[model samples]
Structures are given as structure tokens and as C-alpha cells.
Target chain A: MLVLTEGLVELNVEAKDAEDAIRKAGQLLVNEGLAEARYIDAMVKGFQDIGPYIVVAPNIAFPHARPEAGVIEKGVSIIRLSEPVKFGHPTNDPITLVCALCGVDSKSHIEMLQALATLLRDEDKLKTIMNPEASKQDVLAII
Target chain B: MKIVTVCGMGFGTSLMLLLEIQSIAKGHGFEVNGEAVDLGSAKGMSCDLMVASSEISSELVDEPVEVISINNLLDRNEIEQKVMPAIQKLSKKG
Candidate 1:
């Protein structure tokens, strides 16, 4: 089973900008042995070349790269920014959430993606996770 | 009706959205089928409708296909609100 460990979670992260935010999120996955270090650069370039399209929703940016970019295993990482960063998205700028995804293959990350979508959809649940008062373990249980 | 969920990379957020849309549409009795596609592959593509986060949806704009922008990709209620009407509208056209 793919595990969402506390080790993969970083709350209220301080980032200089979107590039920094993406790298920090990518580093979380890499540190957890879920992805390679170079995967970080891939995600950054993805934004530069592809535009801020990674800002999938308002206040949320789901940064990811191809599986070949450096995915050693399938997993996801959660990084909440202390101050929201801009991805230049027309609507979803100043993102406070960065969810970095690493998949061994296309099919494997589907479950995690579904679960994440469900959790993020619930405003109450998202509030609790982002409340700063909520424990990391609480967010873990929710995820 | 056919719909597609799009993201910069098809396998990530778009795939996430496709599953949620599929689940929501099944219960709505819309008889819809859809898939996840990357923006590059999605261009010049046609479907009854398309769903995506606002930033990506703006790029997805084209004729003969309508794009439904979901401001909050994580919110299921938002998806239902934005998508059901489109599905209802499109299914009627068929």
C-alpha cells in the first residue's frame, strides 16, 4: 500500500515564490524515497514551459512531472505554504497548497488522487488541515 | 454524452478530476462517459463538454466543445453544480 506518512508532510512552509514552493514539495517526495531529486527540477520547468496551469484550483497547486522525471515509487506529498505564492494562474493565483505527486506509472497513483480530491473538496476538512491548530497527525488521519 | 477533464499533464489533476466527474455523473443519470487528457492532446479535441480547473480550462477553449470551469477542483459540490447543468444541457441536444 502507498503510505502517506507524516514524514512526507510539511505544514506552513515558508517559500520565496512558486518555484521555491514547487521545489520544497518535490523535495518532500524525494526525501521520502518516493521520487528522485531531479524530479524537483522537472516540476519547476513544467510550470515555466507549461505556464501556471499547475494551479489546478484557487489556493491550490498540484505540481507534478512525468513518471520518468524521477519517480522511484508512487506517492504524494502535502506542502502548505505559510504565505501563498503566485503561479500566475488567471483565477487560481496566490496558492497556499502544493500537492506534489509522484507515480511509478499512470495507473498506480489513481487511488491517492481520488482520496486527495475527496479530502480537498470538503471545505471543513480542508479547513481543519490548514487551520495551523490542527495537529499533523490529524491531517494524516484525514488524508 | 462525452466529456473530458484536462490538466497540464493528463495523468495528474485531470485524471483526478475525471474520476470525480465520472462518479458524480453516474448518479445524476446523465449517461456520460469521459476521460482524462493533457492540454496538448486536448487541443482541437471535441466532446459534449469539458471540465477542468479554471486556469487549465481557459486554455481548453475551442468551438463545438464547451468548457466548464471549476474554481475549486477539490470541491465535489462545485463540480456537481457546474457540471450537472452542462451535462443536462448537452444530453438534451443529443
Candidate 2:
């Protein structure tokens, strides 16, 4: 996969649920002309049912929908929260990292998941990405 | 031996926890196999014990396997303190 990294970083994001997070991130993608704006809402709802499964790390969350959920192109958007957002899971502390991913199918999505897993495994790299002062270039550099 | 770690997503916290368990098991001279599985899909997995998030453990009560609930998935000390005993107990059974 080409790993879409251009203009994928949002300095601040507001979200109440996995759907909200993905919608916010998808807006960024659409604004940058990377994907269609009309598909954003459907993508958000498509992942809502499996949304609760997104509590990846203590302060990190990855919200993704199924491949068939209006995904015209495979892409990723990284959003850092100014303040943490709760997803109703006790084990998950408020989240800072909100990664929105869209793919063509399960196999393609798993590749993105593996890439995300690799990035999240690095504590120092994650801390840098979560930093408010960090630029989009800095986030892209790490990924 | 098979060990499975459970969390909200099979890809993130559970995978990290499984890595920790694998390292600890290796140090103890145990050749164990481990994987991270989402709570929804862990039903038929052959695992000696299920190390799961507290939320997941509550949902998995009826399973025959034992469940060890973990508070912070990244806290190595906390995981060792809580999970080591469960592993030892299962070892005795084996």
C-alpha cells in the first residue's frame, strides 16, 4: 500500500463517539481533496456498530469503518485531541490519538491496522505525535 | 501452551499485553504460544487463561477458562503483578 500520509494530520479534533471521530477526521481528508465529503457520514455510521472496539491504548483510539463503507480510496487521518474524549470504556483513559482509516476490504484494512500497531508500539513516537506543539510534518516524519 | 490476551480491539492493547506475556513466559523457560483476540471472537480459542481488560472479563464470565483482569494495558509492573500468579496457577494444572 502507498500509505497516504499527505495532509493527514489535524492539530485538534473534537469527538463524542467513534462515528464523530471518524467524521471529524474525514472532513479533513475531504477538505484536502483526498476523498469525497459526501461519504463522510456513511463512513462514520458504518463503523459505529464496531466502534466500541476502537479502544486501542490508554490514551489512543483508532476509529475505522468497514471497507465497503463508501471508501473510494484508501487513506488515513491522524487527529490529536486538545483534551481527551471518553468512549465509555473503563480501561481506556481519555484518548489523545484518533486515527481514522478507510480501506478497500478486510485484507487492505488489516494492512493499515498492522501499520498502526507498529506505530503505536513505540512509546516515544506516540508521545511526540500527541504533543500539541508538534507540526504535521513532525507527525508525518514519525509515521 | 496457548495464551490469549483480550481487549476492545485485537490489534492494539491486547497485542501489547500478549507481547509482555510472551516475554515473561520466555524468561521463565516456558515455550508458550500467545495471540491477541477480541473478546467477541475469543469463544473457541484454546487458551489456558484469558488476560482481558476488566470490561471484557465481565462479559466473558461463562467461559470455562479463567480470566485475569488488567487495569492498565501498558503498565508492565501492574500486568506482572496481576498476571504472573494466574500463569503460575495454570502451570500447576498443566
State interface RMSD in Å for all models: 1.8, 4.4
Q: Which ten residues in a row have the lowest lDDT in candidate 1 chain B?
A: B55-64
The alpha-carbon lDDT assigned to residue B75 of candidate 2 equals 62
lDDT of 1 by residue, B39-87 (tens): 8888877777778777677776564578888877777788989888888
- DockQ, candidate 1, vs. native dimer: 0.65
Residue A143 CA displacement from its true place in model 1, Å: 3.5
Which parts of model 1 have CA positions greater than 4 angstroms off? none
Model 1 Cα lDDT, one tens digit per residue, A56-91 = 667888788889998998898998888888889877
Return the number of clashes found in candidate 1: 1
Candidate 1 residue B94 Cα shift, in angstroms, is 2.1
| lDDT (Cα, 0-100) at B46 in candidate 1 | 70
